[model samples]
Target: MTAVALLLTALFLAPTGALAADKIVIGVPTSLNFLEGKEANNSVKLAVDEINKAGGVKVGGKMLPFVVESIDIRDAAPGVPVPEALLGIEKLILEKKPNALVVGPFRSEALLAGMDMLAKHKVPLLGTIAMSPKTEAKVASDPKYKYVFRVSLDAKYFVGYIAGVMGFLGKEFGFNKVFIMNQDVAWARATAGIMTKIFEGKLKWKVVGHETFPTGASDFAPALMKAKMAGAQVIMPVFDMPQSGILVKQWKAMKVPALMAGFISPLTGPGAWKTFDGKIGGALNAIFELGNIPSAKYPPSKKYYDAYQAKYGVPLEAGHGPAPSYASVYLLKAAIEKAGSLDPDAIVAALKATDAQGVMGHIKFSKGNQLIYGNDPQKEALGCFFQWTDDGKRLIVYPPAIAEGTIKLPAGMKAAK
Candidate 1:
């Protein structure tokens, strides 16, 4: 009788034991474009490690461990031939079949490719970068692609920021006419189009000039000269990191006097500032600097910053792309645990129901597939306007409350005489 009882017990426990051994795999597709994506990938890995140390995710009366599998799609060398990174992402998705996907530090084109695979699989692809509204439109237009969502503010938000800054400058500083230069990418074009409508239609500011440049074009001398000749008070250049830095440096060299400001990648960091120190004109950023603040109203920034610096031995910067990526892991874990199951549908439901406090703020999803804080609609996702100090520190100048100090205009950015 005892032997028979023990055999029954082992049989009953076998499936649950195997389930305990099972791990939830999360896929992260870092962009091949810049270092921000790499940092985001690292942050996601760190969060996964921390969760595992805390005994993994608890669901369905079982504790299942989780692992983050990162795919480095960044181009490493000058010109080594290899499979296109987007195709590699498709292969990873098909092969590993992770439960969820977190993509990018701004690669709208690449993300557009990966979204096709994710939609086919019906897996959730939460984006930390690639904020084009067109990407949102793709999901909204198709009921079948409901699994796609973004935590970051859309491109329109960037346009709003630009318009707000321009309005402030025009009203306060008597800066009127403006020139807009944007990269030829989908995001840049979309953002620039919106800005033109706002400046021309709403503010009544004259659009002295507008131009589009190829994404990797090195020289901005010709474009800058045109804006200068047009007597524009502001020049808004929307492009990626390295190129944006190069553009600013070249603009200064050409002695372009326009107040230069636009969307810049957080990845530009201190290194980029070091190159264009005291040269970059008025600048506004979507991300707030974590290290500079003593205690943010949001709690997770400090905690995450401390843990990250302790582990990585470097002060976390606004451009450190991994901060939000790391937070995504925790956010997903909370959703899965709340749902009490590993089923993708259940997880998705819980994620949509998410009103949990996150590093940024209380992240809640709306029917429009937008993530915003429940506490404040205006304070949805973190963004700020910052300009470089003489000492190369990024000082928050807008929104008043979080200002490190007032914005110090660079030498050549004075009101047009």
Candidate 2:
């Protein structure tokens, strides 16, 4: 009788012990595509470090240490015949059986390449920079893709933000005709499509000119001259930082009359600011303004900025890439605690149920695994417009509540006569 009782007790506790032993692994497949990738990966590292320092993730009444296994796959060489990095990632997933995955600073093409593997494994992927709708389309059609998610907002949200900024410009400053110049990348093309739809369909604004440039083109003089010739009052250029900086310099040299505005990226950082000086303005989804950090409302922002500067020796840029990486880890932690288990399904449920405040404001997931935050007053993607001061300082101009200072049009691009 005594032996029977002891055996039963041991069996009852065995499953609990096994459950407690499960460790939650998070795979980080970060891009080395450019300097932006480096910045984003550093932020991810910082977030993981903070979480580990806090004793890792808790699951089933036991604490399981979180591990971040990073894969660096940068396309630096031409025709070097690199192996498919996603296959290696798949192998890691099968062996480690991670609870979630953090993907990309990689190009859309690279991310598209990995979608099949991720779907096959049923692992959730939160991307930092892959923002094309096609990526979302893949998840929507795949029954196995219930696990994939992205921290970055889609093209629809981006267009909505642009519309809001344009509305503000029209109502407040009497600006009308606009020109849009977009790179031939998936993201840029999608953004241009959305902008055209909103301006033509909803706002009834005239698109004076529309132009597309090949990605990585050295000079933008021809495009700028064409926009000027078309009588465009606002020049909205959608390109990455390096090329955008070159465009700004060339536009200045060519003496284009249109004022510049566009989405913010690594190009709007201090490095780009130093080069472009007084020639940038647009809606910024992320802005690292010092005055915006009021301790009363956002204590964590101050702490994060201070710690980031202390560790990195430079101020953090206002880009979704870095902030989402940090927020995703914390979000994962919250989900784990809520689920009380390391099961992926349970964690996913917890994540969907989240209404927690994160560094990038409130992060809540909808039924389709889409992030539902950042909707503006027009029920669109919420973003604030900002302009570079003549002295070259970035300032929040729209949304009076968060404005650090008033919006000032560039010298040559003042409201149309």
Candidate 3:
């Protein structure tokens, strides 16, 4: 074949630019090695597929499909050095050259380290897993970091939701004494500390005890027993690891009289009903601003929830990760279409002006704050406080406006003795 003919053939087959199957690339630089990172990435992919099927995004008067360029960064797995993830971010930004980045880094350390990199390249990032409020503070203080947006649960939001539930329990059941137990991690510790302040200062409740345990630790007996002995009427457990399954089992086997509430990761989703063998019944769990269980409660969340379930044959991870990551993809599409161009600065401006409904509810990013707006579903992505019913259903039990069930004494609890 002639050289000119071969070159023309290659150009026709290539799926870039405005020729054949053109696409807008979204960079997902995260720890792909673990569940949270993996699921979050999957959610991003799911959104991409949905958008592509819906005729993609219109840009430059042509519809372009969305695609993802995800880097392992060792999958943002825990204990991985921030520098390692930072290098992956650089590679993804410079090499992959995505139009926008979602699910940027799994670790807060990595997120903080990569901020300058995202800004240097002017690639907007929607971080869906880093919980550090410092990220928000950084965005608020510096103009250089304005390209970053946080869709993850800030510690304040998690602790605030748990505390809000505790407040509800206090008024509903005449409960007062509270205890705090946290899995030894920066996010958990920070949240627990905030819980202490809120429990003591605002609620005027007695904090009978405070404890911390390392991640992957088994046998929460010591902490559970301590609460029982301290006359703790309620115990708030701050955990995100899988081993929290052990904590739930111990809470039931020991028959502790106190109501177990807080962000017990294992008990937050529908699977927990079986994973804990119904022991999680009546336990209060915090499902980050995204809706709980089926991940399809709210119309927006339901869309992704159904897509994921249909594609992967499972429900969404009701954790701090996937929901927002999924929503961020749609948010990116909205911003891109709103900007009517692929320019980074224009997209960031449109993102700041977002008022679309997302997984939990309406999503509106704060101008400089860079966090999702408000604590109510009407104004923002309100986190849900849910209880697992004995019949194996998750019922919203807080935020009276959305409450599907009232606060009831946890099923596994014994009468205060």
Candidate 4:
């Protein structure tokens, strides 16, 4: 063929500009049926929409929009086989070829499975939930696994905040003795151990009855009876099971009213109050965020909460849910802009140097890639402890510096029938 004919052929074979829309694809691999999944997905949507409206992230003088593609991992239970859980992330990476991945597996086991795959692929992962300390420890243990970073508070930080609240409960409510109850899972186990140390050693609160139940244990009556028998002034539950509603209901049915707080995942959402038919009232619990809480140092939090309620018609669930996921997107955008490139290594470095404010407060990365927010008593994320009032509203009651209300023990606690 003549040179002119060859040139024409080359022109035709070159990549078409028609398919070239500057956009970054983020892959989310999680279980949509679960709370974390729904919250993270929606939060990411909110952030992406906001960023896109504001002209997206600037890369090499070109603004690139972001699109999130999700892979449903189905129920994120710790009992699910690791191989099966890993497959979701594998499928997402292989099918979507996203610029980064936001990992929000509700179970620690699922996060563990996804971690290895993320490290192998060298894709930067920003984990929002999955608070197992083991995840960050693994990353710290191996330099090759630096690609994984947790944007949410881990178990240690969470337990620390819980301990702080327990101390407050002891001082304010005159609760000298407490009972410990938790699930057998890793996160709960770690929380129980930490609380044990804090109560028994540091704070000098007596730990009376300690019980561990399986994730789906339906009967907490025996445990409540034992706690009351032991004269526990407070009953703390460290759990992650959806069936925690059973425990709460049993607590009320048994009328064992030691001021309750710890592993409050089940009570964080507004829907939970109705789900349990308002039985959560008078229950003191630790929550990571609330629409009007003072720990939400970020000015946009109330706006985010209002917008979420307006959009979903329910209060925003606090914890490692919507807030962190929403903030993670903004954090990623900041990192990408700081890096000025889409390369994984560059983005990872930028993430390490992250220092931005979002709905979750001023997000900054510390040692082990842990995201620190607000004025935590510890150097990690700020923790908020709240109590559900008789009026069906949650009031912040701990960390006196930021508390919006005082501790209110259950009505029948003194009688302890």
Candidate 2 has an lDDT of 0.64
Ranking by TM-score: 3, 4, 2, 1
Q: Which of the predicted structures, 2 or 4, would earn the higher lDDT when compared with the native?
A: 4
lDDT of 2 at 278: 45
The digit string of per-residue lDDT tens for model 4 on 1-417 reads 999999888878764222334799888887877877887788788789889999999887789999999888773754577677778788888888888888557677778767777877888888887777787778778877788888777777777778788776766666779899999976678778888888889898899979999878878889999998998988999876778877877887788868778755778766777888888778877766433232443346667777776777766664556677777788889888898788788889999987655665566776677776444433334557778887778777766645777887777766322
Q: Model 1 — which ten-residue stretch has the worst lDDT?
A: 286-295
In the order shown, what is each candidate's alpha-carbon RMSD? 4.8, 4.6, 4.8, 4.2
lDDT by residue (160-214, candidate 1, tens digit) is 7677768877776788899999888767788889888988899989999999988
TM-score list, all predictions: 0.81, 0.82, 0.90, 0.87
Tens digits of per-residue lDDT, candidate 2, 257-286, equal 776777635455555566555454332323
Best by TM-score: 3
Off by over 4 Å in 2: 1-23, 75-85, 95-97, 108-116, 134-143, 253-255, 264-266, 276-302, 375-383, 399-401
Q: List the residue pairs that clash in candidate 4.
A: none
The predicted structure with the larger lDDT, 1 or 4, is 4
The local distance difference test score of each candidate is 0.67, 0.64, 0.78, 0.75
Q: Write the per-residue lDDT of candidate 3 for residues 149-230, one digit (tens) a residue.
A: 9887676677677777888777777778988888998788888887788888998889999988988898889989999999
True lDDT of residue 398, candidate 1: 52
Count of steric clashes across candidates, in order: 3, 0, 5, 0
lDDT ranking, best first:
3, 4, 1, 2
Candidate 3 global lDDT: 0.78
